[model samples]
Target: MLFFLRMRWHWIVVTTCAFLAIAGTYLLTAEPTFVASTQLVIFPQVSGSEAQRAFAEDAFIEGQLEIARSSDVVGGTVAALDLVHDPEFVDQTPSLQDRAKNWLTGFSSGNGANEVQAQTEEERLHDWATAKLLNMTGIRRIGSSTIIEVSAAASTPQKAVDIADTLARQYIQKNIAMKANAARQYSDWLSTFISEQQRGLADTASALASFTSNPRDQFKLAELQSATDARRSLYENTLNQLTETKQRITYSMSDATIVSPATLPLSKARPRSTLIAAFAAAVGLGAGLALAMIRHASDRRLVRPHQIAETGGLPFVTLLATAKRTRNGHPPRFLAVGTGSSTTARPVIPGMAELSATVVGLRRKRRVVIGVVAVEPGGGASTIACELAVLSSVSGAKTLLIDAAAQKSSLSKAIAPQSSSGLADVLDNGELIETAALPLSPTLKFLPLGRVDTVSPAIRLSSRRTQLSFVELKKEFDSVFVDISAFSASPDANAIAPELDGVLVVASHGRTSIDDAMRVIETLRNVGAEILGAIINHAPKSMQP
Candidate 1:
């Protein structure tokens, strides 16, 4: 419960953080991304020629479209735009190189390119251009037509448009250069072969004529004529091949053309602010819940009186959730609260009005011995012991709060700071118990912790004098509440608690650990202490500032 109260301050922090976190994500992920796109005819001219290629396949269209959208093409576009000079691209250049260089690098590297080193700045620039080009590149068959759609994205509308335009122009020019070179080479080769065949044909024809006209070569006329015919056939074939080559070059010239040009997009292509903000808010909420649960679980402190009750199988007799802390940091005031109902304010002593009640109850029942114990120190157990005495005494019962713990002096000082001697002094040094006992009110009295001049044994009670004093104090009084130390695996509470008519175990919620509370309870039970039940002091709840 204290953990829950502590989280009250967290709500404001969470709200502020969540809002800022979502806003920050929007700022990061949401950006103006202008996408420039254009439609290309895919030069449907050749696409129509392949009879086996169904219109449904759109294979050629898809292949070219993919190439248009490919990283190389986009990279080329980014390079043409000199995006390398952009610092963002520069910083990312190295990572781009790494991705292109390795197989798994694509998964690890964001841009899916090889890492760029300072020495290879140009290469990095090229890679960055490539990555952006790939991102901006979107290629698809134009509704099953040979046509294709091409796009590029940039921060500004003009940049997106310019990139798309540049890519289209550059790719077309490159294809032209390659095809023209091939065409020129073919034309030259065919022209050369045709020339060779023409020369051979002329020589064969001349030889055949000479053989036919000269008597000395009459036997060679038929063979020479056959040779001439073969050469003529070869020359005719070369001429035909040259005509076909020219026709192919003419056909390829117009096969691929950019029919529609790219235009700048008016808006950013990405960085959806609403979507990013929503995603961020969801992530923040989940993380906040996890963090809250983690912190609460780690705090290990007991949170409520009920936690103690459940841990020890004992009902909580009393609890003080928000008792005021002392100057020394322990609970200064005393509270006697019950279950279920919330305690809003600590009731003023009201001139021992409650003291009047406990006395009446005890007197009516003829109570004898009383024991005061705690699950742990710093739990205000001592404070409860002192207040109970004051109430009892004021109510007309001769009450004595015996300082049974030989270890410390907090009880005497806080309850009766001015008193110089107490039960310890009287028991250990034979100081007069009657003198040490202080008169706090007409009905209430105090027993101070004895003189510092005498050191008592750490373990046992002050002495037989204090023991006999307890016996004497109890004779006329309805109850003698012994303020004992927190439980140890010893027989002292055993010796004293059984003699008491009842025991009231004082414990503070959220201060005591479960193990400590259990050990104390078990020890008291072993001592055969009359199980008068438990009191959880300083109960769960936050204190007002």
Candidate 2:
């Protein structure tokens, strides 16, 4: 995670920007809504045992909640509030189908004249308003208690409050109406039953009276009196129940009561801008981190010293910081060295002095020849070779800088631009070696590749004549540094690799691939050349050691 965060930080910034854009768009275009709520308490009439009453109260509360959110209550509220004509309740934006239908209606002649068209439109509007009201209304019981909360949302605070209050009132009215209707039905039935009971009592009384007078059978007379008494008791009980039901209907008592009235909301309920922005930012950061990890996993560049050593199967040397080039038209300085006469110092190439020291320490003899090569082009091999030669000279050692690479003559152009003949002239053209080599400092000499367009033929010629020329040059110079082409580009470096004392491979951080570096090592090993530690060039400042 830390590696990805360090390497792929730009991806994080891009993902954050994308998230902010989407969140800003939603916040700007979304509609604001206000919510208002009212609380109601329900009380069931006690009529049975303790357990039965408790169960009945639970069932009653659940049933009331359902009724409160029912279509009947919502529909009544919509009609009472005249919401069919209200713009907030009705969707003013016409759909494509509605627009097409309106266009057709305007062009049609007989359809517009029909009376049913106007009635159908009114019915559609009413249905739409009822659905809208139901969608905005919410009803839920508060925990295990008999209290319920009713809430409604709308564009305006007043509308939200009005809808909540009206819903509660309509539910209470419906409940009362239902109970009163039931009571009225019971009272009517009881009145008819009472009339029949009174008629039966009169008949029983007449029979008893007649039986007593006749005195023909004592059992029949006692049976008639018992029948008359039972009829009278049933009549009295019916009379009492009928009277109570009538009183209840007159009073019209309801179980639901508004404990808290809905109040106007002070703020909007949805589209919390601050909270939404924070949540979006958090999501964006997480997504960015995930993307950075994926990118880091897929990258193939060798950015660390350990990676180069592990991949190339070689020892790791120090990293070299990238040097700044002069903007003005002057030759670039390689390494910083005191002039021994002035306090003002020239800019020294970073890491070159360290590289030269490493090479010196790795040598077993007093005088040694080291060839600097790279796996790929633009790896700063030539620059390091020149700087190492310069550092060796400043240390009072006779150093020879050879630009043997034929592809690019950058070092020759920078150091000995006036010299027209070099190593190639000495090997192929039979030119004098003393006349071809140019002297830069008192102890430093340079040999350019010398006007060679092709590298392979010149390397072959140098290989045949290398024993005589190289032995005499080694006798005069203390340390020899050869700058050659990239190993992958030509076989020139490999041809001369066996002639040098040791070979140093240069690799650029974040650009050189492990496969390329390994290939270069394998090529040098095939020729039985001595391999020194690798150097990382153009490395970041933090990676320098």
Candidate 3:
């Protein structure tokens, strides 16, 4: 986790900051909404067998729930509370997006304007409140039971409570009204039916009287009397049904009961600030970590010492920190040895002592010419070469520093800037090493890259004279450090690598990639250059540099 943070802290920081800003803006600008809920227990009004009742109970209760959420019920509640003119419902503030949409669409003069003009102001306001109420209300069944929960949201606690309670009451009243209307309709139809039955019964009775008075046949009289009795019985039954229907219409009841009433809410239900902030933080952190992981996986820069060995397949040497220059704009005095010791302690350059000791160990018991070359430019190969030469000379070894880079000789520009003759003169003009080499101390000699007018350093270094000059230098100096051009920049390092005892590859920390280091190592090995080891320069403080 720490590695990921260090590698991609910028990505993490940017993403986390952006999410936090959005969360803060919402918290500050968004309006709070309060919710209040009421519950109802619906009863099945079906008249049937037990099996039929059980089958219809669920469907009946479900229909009641829909009725509770219906527009008629909501509109009735709106009218009861006069919410169309209530300040909480009528004077609500519009959001920025809503205002912008209104502004953009306000200029239209079309059928839409005519449609708005068709409705009266009161009707329009009532319809708007009904729609708004529907949007704010929620109704759902409680488990598998006959109870249902209805909730409403508003900008204030009291308003929310009023809406919920009023809506529930309105639904109950609507149920009562529907039952009353059905009973009344049935009562009117039954009264008409009874009137027809009564007239038919009177006709039958009159026919029986006529038959008796006229002394008809005995069989006809008996049949007429039986018919009169049957008609009278049916008419009395119809009259009783009409009387029962009139009683039902007078005392119609609702099928639903309020199990709970809405109470005034104490807190806002929406814009839950704490949960929102935490959720935002979690989402932001997750997004940041994801991006960090992706970036870390794609990056190939070598930031650790273990990566050097894994990529270049070379022994890991000491890590070097960036060397600081003095106020005079020259290399630090530590680059060269001091003559006298001071009373106060001086800061030691990181990695120099370890590197010098490593070089000495590699020398074994004979003269060793170690060429320092970087995989890429600006890898501090020249600085390493200079330090090694200075340290070796101070330690009583006959040390010689040579700048053999054909293109942009950093060592020549920094160390032997005053010297006019160097390796170029020795290799191309057959100048003696004694005349070309400049002295920095009693034991250290500096050879700069003199002017090469026409001949290329590669061709010159490949000649027999360059090889003989290097052999003579080896016989003269106990240790020689050469600053060769980067392998990517020129082929001078390859040309001079075979002549040296071994070559030290230098790669910059966090700048050189594994692939680039591997390619450099492979190219040097293919040319038969002895692979000594590798050094990592400009390492961060977390490492031992």
Top-scoring candidate (TM-score): 2
Give per-residue CA lDDT, model 3, range 1-545, as digits (tens).
Answer: 77657767888888888898899999889988999999998888777898898779988988888888788899999999999887656654657986776556555646686456435446867888888889999999999888888899998898899989999999998888888888889888888888888898899999988888887599999998998998888888878887887777788678988998999888899999999888988888889889888878887887777776866667656688876776654445323223343212222347877888889887668899999999888887887888888878878888998887777676776665666677877775664677778777788888888877776554576566553366777888999998888889888877778877899999988898978987888888888888788888887655673
Worst 10 residues of 2 by lDDT: 335-344
lDDT of 2 by residue, 1-545 (tens): 56556668888888987898899999899888999999999987766989999898888888888888788899899988899889988876779998888667756846644456667777888889999888888899999998999999998899899999999999999999889999999999999999999999999989898888888988888899899999999999999999999998999988889999999999888888899899889999889888877877777777777876776677646688887676542236532222233211332567666776777665436688888998788888888888788778777788888888887767877666767677767776544668777766788877877777555433764457542356667788888889988887777777888877888898888788767877788888888877777887888776555
The ten-residue window of minimal lDDT in model 1 covers: 335-344
Winner on TM-score between 1 and 2 is 2
Candidate 3 deviation (Cα RMSD): 6.6
How accurate locally, in lDDT, is each candidate?
0.61, 0.80, 0.80
lDDT of 1 by residue, 7-32 (tens): 53384359548876767856876667
lDDT minimum window of 10 residues, candidate 3? 337-346
Q: For all candidates, what are the clash counts?
A: 21, 2, 0
Instruction: Give every collision pair in model 2.
Output: 335-348, 336-348
Candidate 2 lands at a TM-score of 0.76
Candidate 3 Cα outliers beyond 4 Å, as residue runs: 1-34, 43-59, 74-136, 153-163, 197-252, 257-300, 303-353, 390-396, 403-468, 526-528, 540-545
